[model samples]
Target: MLCAVVLNAAQAASAQSVVVQPAVQVRSVTTNNVSFAEAEVARSDSVLIVTPRLDVLTVNPGYRLNASLAADAVTYLGRSQADRLLPRAQADLTAQLVERWLFVDGRLSADTTAGNPFGVLEDESSTIFNRTTVYRQRISPYVERELSPRERLQLRTDHSWFQNRNAGGTDTRIDTYLLSQRASYELRPQPLGLRAEYTRDSSDYSNLPDSSVLFETARLSAMYEAAPQLVLTLTAGSDHARYSGIDQRETLRGFGLRWEPSERTSVGALVEKRFFGTGWAVNLAHRAPFLVLNADMQRRSTTYAAQVAALPAGGDVAQLLDSLLSTRITNPVERATAVQQLIAQRGLPATLASALDLFSPSAQLLNSASLSAALLGVRHTITLRGFYDRTEDLIGVNPPPLFSSNARQYGASLGMTRRLQPDATADFSLTRSRVVGFGTNAGVVTNNLSVRFGASRQLSLRTTVSAALRRQWVDSTAVTNANQTALSFGLLHRF
Candidate 1:
């Protein structure tokens, strides 16, 4: 069913509208012999302006701007009596400048929140309130300028800063800046083009033992259509990174190509060389009717180096040989060897460097594969897929119970996705994974089950629900170590 209403009686040539809405949510959690529930109610209001004339701001440009301002506040159960539910506010303005070559956009947002852990407060385990309000604000501004015909240049800069103050005596701040320059050239229209870009990144940290880090990257690429049905692309780039106060340096050189013969077929490959870095990898994937497969073969090795921020012990001595023998100094501007820079980079202290070998990069090999197939037939409504995968990482996040000389993972999965209706669908999947650590501890195995249901009616209404369950165990522990469950539901309406 469709309903349409039209009114042409507005007195002005341009008009605006304001919209207000509200919502409420309830939540519950059960974990590790602990169960809790909470409810929250929120109110939101928004004002929007619609310009009927194309030239609402300036008659010469012939454009319109949509601007909106919104604010919301929510109150949740269980909180300190002195605390207040601070409201969040936002403002947006999208302006069309010159209607084409140049445009501007801006947005601002702010919000606050409270603390958690009810038991800690009730039992007086700690004297602290464990909660404090934080203020977050941001703004984004951009401009575009056209350089010439057949060739164009673009420059963009972004700046952001954050400050955090604790109720106690703790305080911290962050400032970030980014700049990008890009140029696009049409060798023979857009079908054949060349592109180049360069970017620089720097970070300075202060507080306990202040430090700074910086990096520069540049890339050049060309893409062209060899045939109406075939397209090819190639790209090359390099990156140099320097750790802040540590004065440590890392660099990477990479090149790759991608080819697409038809809408149904594609292939791509890439290789990279690194300086004072980890390792390298290879990846590949292909798709076909009734069956789809992807595989990745990779090797990675990193030194058991200590954190530069907390240097403990010197790592394997082989790093000295790797650095002196492998890395070559090359000048970017002169395109010549620059052994002086290499010697300078080597002078920095390794204490504040990665726990890995400072002189050499670690190496590791990893492989993974996955597959899926159309269940019965193309005309058959049901689809089925099965996938298997594995990974090999030398280090684990946890050193003790999860300790390993090399970590290995294995998994297999089965999935069924079906169309229940033109506008609705459902899917179910199950997967099992096993992880074996190189250490003496027992390996772990986990099984995951999930289901999803979704419905959509164009722009009017949509609903989706997904649920997951999992069981995990370690080879040494014989119990149902952990049983987990989760679910999410969402609904959206447009008018």
Candidate 2:
């Protein structure tokens, strides 16, 4: 359905001149796993997956469009119940409906993944890597109008849905929606600005009615530019929520400052007070010739669906920097080399070079802090990062036997990546996490180590062969001791 929609939109835009690109891939994978239970009673499986992808881009003076679609067909060698096809699609559109006065933006995406391991797309380290698949869809639309030269108005809405089947042979569904509007105006035309905004969020769960929530918030803010490198902001707000037929209201106020004294350094801080508690946040970042640093701390109240919605929408900063560097080089191999050289020259930290996939979303209010640093070398890179989080009223199992309790989590990771040759690269990482204060799974520890070596060589004008081996280990109270290993080889021909 999503592919059809994207194709139709592309066809319509092609009438006015649009660009389209397509790609295809075929891969074979074999894996052995000893999951949960005793190590002696593990399971192994072999599978093959084939994928085809398409990308379309349309651009003009007043409008732009980008869309991509990929379909994956999986076949199990001896397990007929674990074979299925999945489709992933994404689309983004922006248009200037009425010159510079009015604009529109929209995005749509759909994905399918295994429910265990928190539906992570590429990793299989969960205790129960079941065959059941979960499907998720998201849509966002936004509009903005220029009320005046120094004033603007905007409106945005988001809708997301999740569907899956549980072990009890029942279907589960979750729906979430968000609506917001904002108006901003310059107060004195000299670094003074004022803004007002309103936001509403709603979440509904088919199997967990008591967990549903509806919340509304309104805020007014004032900003002053103290100097060329400093700015201050103050905000006052109120929140009203309805949960399980109970209504509650709270007052909120906050102060913030942003300072950037140099080209390579920046600092930000915010302190807020609310009826339920006081929250504070801080961020510091610096880039040097040989090192990069980033640190942050935050305290906030959020629900499960809201947290999921707040996940990063784009790739990490490292990937963004690589893309920017790629535009300067025409050759694909040279672009990769230039990106690595630029990363080393700019002292891009190790923590920012790779995505932080350790954190897990929980349906609880929490306070968290993290620090990451990266050291770039001539031919190698090293990174270190740590995080700590404390959750309030953590939700556990069901409500019958009461398995919910508060918990604290902390973790650290160390990683290194090296260029073995012009066409070969190697990466290694080790991570450890611990959870405490939970009811049954108190003092649970998980450790994972992964290493991969990849090389590519052209066989013909449009063909290449690549191979890799991956090993992972998971140790936890829930999963006991489990080990997984996989070796894969693929042949690709692009046109």
Candidate 3:
């Protein structure tokens, strides 16, 4: 019970739903099946928390092979028509070394989403939002050792290489150069915890149009349950990120609190504040069996940067800069010049220039604010439900924007669910999205409609279908939005 509270607090602390990495400001999970990032967010990305057993395989004293396939269309955004798919068919080999002191095991997996970078692989895969296909030609290997029942250590690794991608687009083609390590420890006698991780992502971009950004990361966190109804947590971390041949450092310092009043009632708040000249935000949330509510108000300010060969590179690092930016090497100094020329030759886009212009001193409020509320109920007989939330986001130019130039987002959503049996259910929902801002795409309207059917019992099969349409009141060179619709079918088995 205490462990549950601590986990909830951790999610409340890391609620942005976005992490800026060297490769990209990843909004969703990529290759790692285990969603460390999403776990920090407010919700569980996994559709099925437990997979039911169909049959069991036991070889001699310490070996087993279990098989099953499952899929579901998992979406973070209520309006996103693009959902993920995961059809997992796997087997395992286990061996016992000592009574309970130590043992090692490995597994191999095959998935439908192994190629086609933009392909949808899982109907309920956690990486659905990324829209990237991850595949392997042969068997994948994993090793596990038991340190104790409550606390354990693990070392797992995998390698991949992608092929044949359209160059007119972005990051494609993978290289077998990335390696990662993870370790987790459970605090004794109480629900407390600590974790550390490091990784090197060096995928090649030869098949794509963008440069491959290598990501190196280090992180640590501590958490504790302060009371039966509340939990507190602290996190500190740093990332040395390199992108487009340029290096930048990202630091983190955050804290959070969560309060659960009863089995059916809970409230949460989080503060993610950074030391850099960046920005910070606080999130508040409340939930119940039949109702859930959320509100987010955040502000971020950025500096407008300019580069000139005439500007002094003066500093103790000048010697190092000279060596790093040699003609033979693709370095920051040289790349800065090329980017400067590009901005000068074409003249930077007005919209972007205006966004960067926020850095200038302004008397307006630098804080963005909004409110959201949603309600849902089910009679348990027919399985009926509905929900809605509204928020006003002023994100354009610092806070208070131009007063007249502010970006306001208004969203309204309604949904319902029904049960066909004790094991099968169906859901249907419709959503409307509107945005008012300074850009040409401002004052836009988007509508999303969807339906889903699921089975949670034996011979599991789940599927969902949805579509989205976006319309802009004013014409713009950028995409107004794309019309998307997808369907999925999946099965899961366990032993």
Global lDDT of each candidate: 0.31, 0.56, 0.33
What lDDT tens digits, residue by residue, belong to model 3 across residues 1-495?
Answer: 224323433444443122111110012222322222222332333222222222223333333333323333344443323445443344443444443433344444433321311121122323343233323222223445555655555544434332222111234342222233334443422577654545444433332233334445455667677787777777677655444344657786677666777744456655544322344455554444333444455544211111000111111122212232343335433433433222212211101000101111111123444443333223121111122212222232223312122333333333334445544444443344333343423543333222333222223222222211211121212223222233323333211
Root-mean-square deviation of every model = 18.8, 6.2, 21.4
Most accurate candidate by lDDT: 2
Residue-wise C-alpha lDDT for candidate 2, range 191-268, written one tens digit per residue? 887777787777665544466556677878788889987889898999776654557689979999889999778999
Task: Specify the poorest-scoring 10-residue window by lDDT in model 1.
Answer: 117-126
Which candidate number would show the highest TM-score if scored against the true structure?
2
Clashes of each: 15, 2, 14
TM-score of each: 0.41, 0.74, 0.37
List runs of model 3 lying over 4 Å from the truth. Answer: 1-178, 185-210, 217-225, 229-231, 235-238, 249-252, 257-428, 431-495
**lDDT leaderboard ranking:** 2, 3, 1
